[model samples]
Target: MSFTVLLEFQLKDGVENAPEILREVLAQTGAFAGNEGLEVLIDDDDASKLIVVEKWASVDARNAYVAWRATPEGRTVSAS
Candidate 1:
């Protein structure tokens, strides 16, 4: 079965381009193995609040992705 992951982020004031940055970061996420799809949701009353809905092929796939994200290579991609 498929798995879903929700990630919430609260941006500080003055970060008007946060969505654009998220798009750039999500490019890598979308290309990762076993990633099915994803969607970005913004709070109706709070633009600074964002939620990322990620779909994976399976729970194991999502776990593997999370593990990879903890590695140096994954950290580099996120830190960029």
Candidate 2:
């Protein structure tokens, strides 16, 4: 079965063009193993609020991806 993950983000003040930044950052997420698709939703009333919808092939696949994101390599990517 497919698995879905929803991540919400609240951008700090003076963070310009959040959607563009999120698109760039989430490129890696879309390319990650078992990733089926990804979508970003911005709140109508609050532009600072964003939600990331991630679809994965399975629960195990999602767990594996999360585990990998905790590693040094993943941390490096996240830091970029």
Candidate 3:
């Protein structure tokens, strides 16, 4: 089955490097094989906050991505 992944992030105070981060994230997502697509939306109340949404073609694909994100770096990324 297909799956959708939604990631919400709040940038640290004065973290004005959203563009660079977005580029990096986009690169990572693109490098992955199972990404159906991705969408990034800015929060209306906080410009520094964003939501990254992804669509996958199957649960296997989504699960693989989740597994990838659950690594040490993923834990760090998910923590804050």
lDDT per residue (tens digit) for residues 1-67 in model 2: 9978999988877756655667666887898889999988989999889899999999888888788
RMSD of 1: 2.5
Ranked candidates (lDDT, high to low) = 1, 2, 3
Please provide TM-scores, in order, for all candidate models, with all chains considered together.
0.80, 0.80, 0.70
Q: Could you tell me how far off, in angstroms, the CA of residue 35 lies in candidate 2 after the best superposition? A: 0.5
Candidate 2 Cα lDDT to native: 0.81
What's each prediction's clash count?
A: 0, 0, 0
Per-model RMSD to reference: 2.5, 2.6, 3.4
Residue 75 C-alpha lDDT in model 1: 60
Off by over 4 Å in 2: 16-21, 76-80
Per-residue lDDT value at 77 in model 2: 28
Candidate 1, which ten residues in sequence have the lowest lDDT sum?
Answer: 71-80
Clashes of 2: 0
In model 3, the worst 10-residue window by lDDT is: 71-80
